[model samples]
Target: MPEALLLVLMAVLGAAVILVLGLVAFRAAGDRSALAPPMPAAYRDDATGAWRRGTLRFVDDRLALKGSGGLAAGPWMRGNLDLGIARPLAAAEAATLGRSNLIQVPATYGTSTFELALDEQHYTALRAWVEAVPPGWNSQVA
Candidate 1:
C-alpha cells in the first residue's frame, strides 16, 4: 500500500515538473528584444473555450498571452495579430458590444479572434501602441 501511494505521488510530481518546464519554454520561445512590457487583460482560453485572465504583450507583430488562472490556465502562447491586413475594430463599433472597455482584436494564429477587456485609462494606450507599429514592418508575416 505504501509503495502504491509513493508511486501515485511520484506521478503527480512528474506531471507538475513537466508543466512548469512547458510554461518556461513557451515564455522563452519568442524574440526577447521585440517583446513589449506585459499588461493585464482577459484572453479567451483556447483549451477550455472560456475567457481567462492573462497578461497580454506584444512580441514583435504578434501578441502573446500568459495566463494567470492556475496551472491549468495553459501555456504562454502567441498569435499573429495579422496587423498587415487587419486593424483593431473601431472603438465606436466595439463599444456597441455593450462593454465600453472591450476591444476585439483579430489574429491569424493562437486564439484567432479574441476580445481583450481593458480599463478605460489603459485602452487608449494599447490601441495607440498597436496602431503605431510601422506599416512597413507589418508586411512580413511574424
Candidate 2:
C-alpha cells in the first residue's frame, strides 16, 4: 500500500511538472507571435523603383531576412535588402555622391536598408550623406 501511494505521488508530481512546462512553452510562443510580422520582400509604390523591406535578425554567424505582408509570403534571403530602390534621380545622386552606396535610407518609422550597389562616382557623396544621418532617423516613418 505504501509503495502504491509513493508511485501515485511520483506520478502526480510528474504530471504537474509536465503541465507547467507545457504552459511555459505556450507562453513563449505567444510572446514571439506578438512581435511585429517580418517586413515584406517587395513593396510596390505608385511612384517608381523596386523596394524590398524585411528584418535583419542576427543569430551568431547567420542572419535572417524576414519578409512582411499578409497574403503573399516572400522568400528569406541570406542577405536581404530591407530597403527598396530610391527614385531614379534620387538613387543616382545617392550613388554618385555617396560612396558607401545607399544600402539603407533613414526613415521615420524604421531604418531603410538596401541591397542595391552604387557606382564609384557616387561613393563619396553616398558616404557623406549616410554619415551625416542622425542615429534613429530611420525610426521615423517619413
Candidate 3:
C-alpha cells in the first residue's frame, strides 16, 4: 500500500511540473517581445499546413527571415534567422506542391532548392529579387 501511494505521488508531481512548464511556454508565446521586428508578410509553411506570417529583412545583399509569426507574439526557435541568402538570386519558378502554391528558387549558394509558399505580394518580391541579378552576372540556365 505504501509503495502504491508513493507511485501515485510521483505521478502527481510529474503532472504538476508538466503543467507549470506548459503555462510558462504559453505565456511566453504570447509575449510581443518574443517576435523580432520589421513587420511580416503571410506565407504558408510548406512543411506544415498552418499559415504563418514572417518578418523578411533584406540587408547587406542578403535576405533574412525573422519572426515566423507576424511581428506580434510567438516563441521563436534558436537560429531561426541565422541563415540567409547571400548570393545573387537568378531564375525562379512558380509551382504547386500538393495544394500549396510554391515558388522554387534554384539555390545559388547551396545545393538544396529554396522553396516558399508566399502570398501574391511576397511571391512578386521573391521573383523581383531573382530578377535583380546584375547584367554582368551570367544567369543562363545551362
For each candidate, the alpha-carbon lDDT, in order, equals: 0.54, 0.41, 0.44
Assess candidate 3 and give its lDDT: 0.44
31-104: candidate 2 lDDT, tens digit per residue: 36522333222222323455444343323222244445423222323232233334333565444433333433
Residues 1-142 of candidate 3: C-alpha lDDT, one tens digit per residue: 9999999999999999999999989856544332233333333333334434455544434455554433432222222222233332122322222323443222222332333344445556655655565564545647
Lowest summed lDDT over 10 consecutive residues: which window, candidate 2? Answer: 72-81
Best by TM-score: 1
Q: Top lDDT: which candidate number?
A: 1
Candidate 2: list runs displaced more than 4 Å: 37-142
- Cα distance off (Å), candidate 3, residue 32: 21
TM-score of each: 0.42, 0.26, 0.34
Local error of candidate 3 at residue 30 (angstroms): 25
C-alpha displacement of 42 in model 1, angstroms?
0.5
Candidate 2 lDDT (Cα, 0 to 1): 0.41
Candidate ranking (lDDT, best to worst) = 1, 3, 2
The stretch of ten residues in a row with the least summed lDDT in candidate 1 is: 71-80
* Backbone clashes, candidate 3: 0
